[model samples]
Target chain A: MELTIKQKKKIRRAAIFTALLLFVLVWLLPVFGALLTSFRTMDDLMNNGFWRMPEKITFKNFGTAWSEGRLNRYLLNSFIITIPSLIGTLALSSMVGFALAKYKFKGNMALYLMFVAGMLIPFQILLIPVFKLSNELGIYNSYWGLIMIHLVFQMGFCSFFLRNYMITIPDELSEAARIDGASEFRIFYQIYLPLSKPALAALGTLEFTWIFNDYIWALVLLRDDKLKPVTAGLATLKGNFITSWSVLVAGAILATLPTIFVFIFLQKYFIKGLTMGSGK
Target chain B: MKRKFVPWMFLLLPLILYTIWVIAPTIYTFYLSFTEWDGLTSPQFIGLENYKYLFDDPTFYKSLINNLKWLIIFLAFPVVVGLFLAMLLSQDIKWARGFKASIYSPMILAPVVIGLIWSWIYQPQGGLLNNTLTYIGLKSLTRGWLSNPETALYAVIGAAVWRHTGYVMLLFLAGLTSISPTVIEASKIDGASAWQRFRFIILPLLKPTTVIVIVITMIQSLRAFDFVSMMTRGGPFNSTNVLAFYMYSEAFRNYNMGYGAAIAVILFLIMFVFIALYLRQIRKGELE
Candidate 1:
């Protein structure tokens, strides 16, 4: 039977709509279920299904997670590691990127390629060596070790990102500054730094979330319970609360908030930063 | 003298720091791969023993195969699903932004958080996934999703696909936006069906984005560690172990630094090959 054009179009439209709705439900189910679980009591979770409504909503789980789980300490540790890593990556990568982008030097392209190659190398490849080196240098289990690893790993991508952005900044700006008697350092500080704020902010936000959420590195390098960040901390929480579903949900939700906040606040720049390498 | 000093001065700090921290360690890692040292013992020349061990170890092979599985599955699911969603959402749909955000929110959560959340969902007895299965009257389908060796690795991959499809969708969305509206309009005016428009116009135009997505996904999937560690700890007799997690276990947990270094080198070579191939493809695309 030959179908009319209008009928075919209508069928296609309905099929597409159904597919979209089904995909949306699949995406949202776990998140919504987790949210609902976070608000229920352990008794409620044990007695009722995760999807079921509780007799009353409660904030006790969040309170327990915050205090007993020592999330405040982990949050502080995350910031301590994240901030320096951010500053170090941005500062080193920008300077290196500026030199590569602006000045003609021997092995400039070679160095740039080195960073690009480094980006492709998985962190696992670097893990054992880094851990050994950190231990040998007496920085293992210390915040410094974690920060250094993050800086080194981040340098490759940051330089790659900043170089691409810096290339578009035009050589004329730097040359004009040089003609006006601005030293290179002075120009980097006074001109380039100011102009690169948006890019820096974008990269910084993304990197902060990454470093804060880093688990494998922290697990390998930082052995002391006191030094572990929220990600690794939550893993410990999982171990302790293995049977307590409500507490686990609470811990997971708490761990997710900082990254969510960063995303919500820097939503626009975060998207741009994430897609930076893809476009080029 | 001032001019000469200025260049060197500007280069001093970064070069010195990066060399000490980055370049030196990389070279050292290679050298360490040939030595027998466990972070406490004196370094002794071991030749190729570590590499030989890596080749023979069942765990390493399991990891390598699992890594391959992850790469293939991760590459297919996100791109195919993401492209489909992006195309669908590209239509003049209500609440498209909300839909996009709901999909993308998981990507923003830390992988550890994702791992934890999914582990709960994959719980054998009373977890969300099993409960839903039982709720819908398919009680027999409910099983130990992450505990059983057969489904452990795939279960983690499912979690990853859930987290990443939106990210890949965003990339496709951006690629879709850059496609000229005039081309799409002209195709429509030719009485091209939706399938024809997608096949003849959209797909041809989306090649660059697809390349980017594939390369990124391949790289990420190969390096996947957190999910494996958190969800399975490569457990149920080393079922879900991937190269990254295996490398971690060897070095940190087992104190086999040299062996771990060997695994790392292998992983590096695998990634290098993929990246080199991708760069060549990108160069070819540019020429075209």
Candidate 2:
């Protein structure tokens, strides 16, 4: 008995579905463990172990993690750090991106290459130098210092991405605006900026997540616990809450919520930004 | 005149910031590599001394070798698996968005969170991994995966690969989406087998994406500090030390700023090769 083409296609689809289902489950096992463990009490983990289901679920960890673990403050710091950095990055990068995309000048490619390559430059080299520079500049251990670094350092990647994106925007629009006697800055503000919203929104989400989750910069640059962003703060919680698995894991989850939220909300733009920059 | 000047007006602030924070520091790192500085005092000139010391340091060699190991494994595993997953998801499969969201969720989590999550999984006693091993009656295979020197680096690498696969998949999915469907349909009408079509058509067309993926992966492997720092801190006797972590520990922990700068210089030089290739690719269009 030969199977019909539709039947064969159906069978093949089912097979692919099952295979993907199995693979995704395996891939997500660690996350599932963290999520499950976050809901259980320490006693439950101690008695049942990390592999088993919780005997009694608890939600107190979230409350305690927020108030006691100092995650609330850290989360606030993350927002404080990320929002300004995001705004600054967008403003600076968009301008540079526009300049690089719209202008014809000596050292244009050189400037563009500098930004792109700077994005990929190893941070290890900048670690000590930036730390020293920050201290020398009287901005050490301050939110502004970290915010400044994030904005400046991220400008390279953001400008690079936005430049690639802006290049695809037809030149005729800008040229038409120029012939209308509009000033360059006015044309940028009115026309190019509006057109660049998708790219800006994409870069905004990416930069927000990156600056919010940054651990290395926050660790070396800031000294005060109150100044630490969620990533660095949660790491400190890991050490301080050595015996409390629930609170630590809860804090970890809480720390990721903002970025996760941004990712979910701006997912379309996020992926678009990523694919756009990859030379698609 | 006004046209040329207008672009510079836009470029001024970013250029100043980039030069100060990125370019100057990069140049200073190279200069610092040739001197001895404790980071508190002035750096004293000692040309090539740090490099000579790095050449003779066993830990440096270990870290270099470990970085190579990381690069090789990353290229082999995540890139391959990501491409496979991308291809699978690209076939008009059901619930592709849900699956993609699930797979790509880990990439959004901070390295600290990922580190802690994997620690729970790799914990020797009552940890998920060991318990699963024991549940299936392979208790002998279960041991302290992270505490053991032999498995520490590999174990950390395993966790990193988990976080990285989704990113690679996202990249490949983008690449796959841009591929024109007419070409594939034509090949299929000619009775090309799935394997033949992929090999002869899809693979050849995906060269640009492949270049980007390989370069990005290589650079990422070189920057493999976060997971190592979060999980092991180059521990079990520095068995997991990559160059980035080693440099951090040396400069920050031990106050060997000059030595750390030298290590950074070396890492930068290694990354420069891939960066150059990537730039060459981008330059082909020349912002047209």
CAPRI grade, predicted model 2: medium
Q: Write the per-residue lDDT of candidate 1 for residues B125-149, one digit (tens) a residue.
A: 5589987887788989989999899
Q: Write the per-residue lDDT of candidate 2 for residues B111-198, one digit (tens) a residue.
A: 8788887877788875779878987889999999999999999999998998888888999999888899999999999999999999
**Model 2 ranges off by over 4 Å:** none
Please name the candidate that would achieve the greatest TM-score relative to the true structure: 2
Model 1 regions more than 4 Å off: A1-18, B1-11, B281-288
**DockQ per candidate, 2 decimals:** 0.59, 0.77
Which pairs of residues clash in candidate 2, taking residues 3 or more apart in a chain or in different chains? none
RMSD of 2: 1.4
True lDDT of residue B176, candidate 1: 93
In CAPRI terms, model 1 is classed as medium
Taking the tens digit of each residue's C-alpha lDDT, what string does model 2 give over A76-110? 99999888998988899999999998888998889
Model 1 CA lDDT for position A103: 70
